[model samples]
Target chain A: MAFSAFASAPAAAEPAVRRRSWVALVLLLPGILYLLLFFITPLVSLVFTSFQQPVIGGDIGQYSAGFKWENYTESVTQYLPLILRAFGYAVLATVLALVISYPLAYFIGVKVRSFPLVQSLLLTLVIAPFFISFLLRTLAWKQIMSDEGPIVVALKALSVFPNDGHITGTPFAVVFGLTYNFIPFMTLPLYATLERLDVRYIEAGNDLYASPFTTFRKITVPLSLPGIVSGTLLTFIPAAGDYINASGDFLGSAQTSMVGNAIESNFLVTQNYPVAAALSIVLMAVILVIVGLYVRRAGTEDLV
Target chain B: MAAGTFAEKGADLELVGITKTFPGFTAIQSLDLFIPAGSFFALLGPSGCGKTTTLRLVAGLEEPTAGRIVIGGQDVTATKSFQRPVNTVFQSYALFPHMTVLENVAFGLRRRSIASPLEKAHEALRLVELDHLAARRPGQLSGGQQQRVALARAVVNRPALLLLDEPLGALDLKLRRQMQLELKDIQSEVGLTFLHVTHDQEEAMTMADTIAVMNKGEIEQMGAPEELYELPRTAFVANFLGQSNLFTGEVSGSTPDALTVAIAGQRLIIPTARAPRRKGTVTVGVRPEKLLLLTSAPAPSSGSNALGPGRVIDVSFSGVSTQYTVAIPGAGDVVVFAQNMVFGPVVHVGAEVWVSWNVEHGFGLEDSVEEAAAGVQDAAAAQSADADTRTGVTSSVRA
Candidate 1:
């Protein structure tokens, strides 16, 4: 009863404080309205459109008249395999990028801290490829993999593969391109996190009679987990939604079409707004679930 | 040439002329030291005086440019840190953030080619009185608790030597005092030789059985803490170890057991039974606490000496004691400290006082005077050369 009375006392005094807080609310009204109008309204409209069909006059008011469940069901049934394939490619690309970039990042961050010029040069190299347009970069890869290109001729000379004229229209090529495009994203975050790590931990490990490999495994790896989690998420999410290289000259095959390609086709060619909205919702949901589990396992503070 | 044999029992570690040099500068130069078996030795110095470097050399984190390191009578100069039987508690504690207290303490044991890891780790934690924090991560523990965990981790290995690099520097004053006594007690209980590095004079005096005072890559003096304080051999040692009043003088005459030095137109005889030789020019050193203040002159005594007749320039009333800066005829100023005997009249600022000490309380530094004068000349020449080289490098870097 005393606790209840104490709580009530605070509640009775809150109205005057709340009236003052209204002044702050008034000051924040513009930003709040801007977010509600531009960000939340679009998301709500998209959600509504994902379940509603267009009327005869092609007006959005038809969404209030009726709802269509077939949009969602049809997307799951017809495009499930494509969505799964996109996720698979994203996972493969993220893993490959991590494997290739972690050691490089460690070397640059820790081993080269005394040489600022070398570190800056390496960072510039990582970011240099991003300066070119995405379409141009993918097109350049296509040209390099063509029959008359040096890669094909060299492979033929080495007898690595049958003079299989061009390897362009393949899922392997699409994944390779995606991995190459997203490697910088993985490496930069890993470098940032690894750079902030205290090198004294390694020395302490050595003092504890741990060999170099044991120290790296026990101290370096576990301490860099936050970086690894963040780098993987940063790379995988964007790679999964990427369709520029898959639909461009790099790999113009049905087998290589990701959910992004499917959404683009629905919006631009077929004009099926409902199905496109459904596909977008599904992709967002899948990404949310995967990222949610990853953050939970690693802890939210690490993810941020 | 005077290499000593290792003790048959207990932890034995020795460094023979260990030297560490950076690109163009030497951090430690030809330092020969030995930690007697089961002794708590302190490497004490001011900041950047190479005490920490000496500890690192012993711990195998750093390789000496020219020397040998032997631990437990085994030559460990060429061995890696992990292969040596020495462990270090770094200044920052360096506890693994990812591991719990139990896991951190168990790290070394788990890596060892041993059978029962958990039992050993548990026993070690219990020894440090940290068994209750077994499951807590290092980040969750307080600074003192983290220090305990670090100690537990190092001791669990049962290494021949424990090297501590200012392990308690991060703690607050009260906690540090508590840890200092605890560390000494733990060393005695464990019966392990500890090579601890610190710049705090009080910490070294409180914890060490033997303290080596270092300066500019060299050991200035090494002895028991009280011996070094009472009879510092050089002006550097006297100033670095504690606050001392120094007076430069020329030796006027000498006997077998005493030397009369003339300072500021006053003749003061120093009882120097331990003097290396009959002196020429000397620096007389006396601790502030040793000087006595007399309002009236005493009868002539054989062992009595006086260094001043000037007025008191300033007086500071510290809680437990009072300090007076007395001015002399030729000497600039001399400080004297007296413990508060009773709550009587406080010494006024401008009171005339006689500063005196017994001959036994004064130490003569005639040999150090010659060495210091030569060192100053050489240092001046070296400074010019260094200035030229630095300017050249700056120009090149700019280009």
Candidate 2:
């Protein structure tokens, strides 16, 4: 609760400029009241639950409120592999999405700028896939890569797939699903930035005796850094916390379960609320630290 | 060695039979031009008159559909833009937003095997007097400073030819005047061939040694500023460069040196030696400053001023001159600008005056009156239409 409040405090400074105004306070009452009820109250209770102790000689789900910080340590020790695997899959998917989206965005933004008809048509095609349900799309991908699907059958006939090898319930399928689903998230921000790029800079580069490749490297790449940063962040954050694609009933099996699956099973099936809440808090903290380091190391602070 | 050859014979930039066609329009048509080495030349015209197209052709930014380009006695028509021995200062400045001022100036040098790139970049910045701001990005500088940086970047390469495409168009009026003088000074100090393209008549006249006035993808007239202004051969040239009072006339009599034209039943004499193509039907043009207004009748023996009575229809007093539009009995409205000396004779709107000018002051032109009027109307319509389309003016975005 304190962390979230610190993150959003800067954005609330405008209305607070009039420090003595009851009208400003009144205007913010509804939103503040809503956050207190739905967000802050539940968040405080979750933190309380994270410190609860399991009751001795009681039912399996019974517990008592106490100082049990050991719950956080035990959860981290047991689920450390799943936590690291989740981040690895997220990093791979985010990188793949960025590599695939940058060229597609550039082609739609700069190459077809003169032809408004073709440009809008291609942009619409990029976004049209979102009209279908996300679960349906992932399910369709599952069918396409299943053991009985044409891709697996064709590989088996060509002797590329061994008799015992399979693509279903593998890490490859999970990462592929994550990348395919989050491509639009990566593309939209990139398109918005590249669409406004000035072509005159490129011509100026050529006029200065720089070759076409050098011009793209020095001018185009640096100008588009903001798009690349935003797109990667957008794809990576949600992919790190996603559970459906890595669940046992979906693309992954028991061996490939991620941190999200572990938290889900602990919370719903086992009814161990303290351990689940501890894992959730740890996941949020770890993501925040990784993102902060990535942003600092990217060294695009001046460009943005 | 290449610089030695260029210095010996000048830049010697040449364009032979150049033509450029878009989807349905031909921007340039068989244009032929030769820019002498180490000369400050300008291509001056109104909007869409192919002046910019000609500059881009020379810069190798656009390949001409038909002609060949030769620079320093070498054929460069087939070469790419980066391979040409030339550089351009873009109208937008187009400074690399991510690079500092020093890096922007050193961009061209770093691409090739140049020695002491950092020293050379600082020297170029010193020429533009912006060396102290070398560590700052282009966005941190003012518009005038950015313009100077662009100039420094282009000149640092020291190519055979330097092309400036409206390099001062984005500055304020006062800054533009200052940069115009600075650009001219830079060109002379460097002694490289400078080809400037602009639509501003005053800028072109003040900076260029030779000016080519282009119209509709063709050169209408090319000469020194005084020559083009004094002895314009066509109605378009006379009206475009400066204001001219033109009257349609017919050649009633002729001499070996002059011709007497009958204009509105009044006889006017124009020198035949000075006129280029004088058909029987000709248009007589006179500069507004050349016509002298005399409220009183001239002496009977005076032969220098050919006199006619007219009524003043309009009067405007500027700081240095008083311009009057007089409606004459035979000729249409004749505009006369008199120097504001001693503030004598405050002419009212309805005052009667005698409009007189020397016979040599009038020149015959080739365009008919109908053609001139239609051309002016078309130009006015085009200007307003252009303004409507460019209504959304935006400030430059910088990081």
The segments of candidate 2 whose C-alpha lies over 4 angstroms from its true place after superposition are A1-30, A34-43, A115-117, A299-301, B1-10, B296-307, B344-346, B368-371, B374-399
| CA error at residue B280 for candidate 1, angstroms | 2.1
Question: Over 4 Å off in model 1, which ranges?
Answer: A1-39, A42-74, A115-118, A300-304, B1-10, B113-122, B345-351, B370-399
If you score just chain A, what TM-score does every candidate get?
A: 0.84, 0.86
Q: How many residue pairs clash in model 1?
A: 0
lDDT of 2 by residue, A1-304 (tens): 3355556766778667757988878999999999999999998888898899999998988989998999899999999999999999999999999999999999988888899999899889889889999888888888888889988999999998997777878999999999999999999889988998899998899888888999988998889888888899999999998888887667777877888988999899999989998998889889999989988876787762
The model with the greatest TM-score is 2
For candidate 2, please provide the TM-score of chain A on its own: 0.86
Model 1 chain A poorest ten-residue lDDT run: A57-66
Per-model CA lDDT versus the true structure: 0.82, 0.85
For candidate 1, give the docking quality class from DockQ: acceptable
Q: What interface Cα RMSD is found for model 2? A: 8.6
B119-141 per-residue lDDT for model 1 (tens digits):
77789888778898898889989
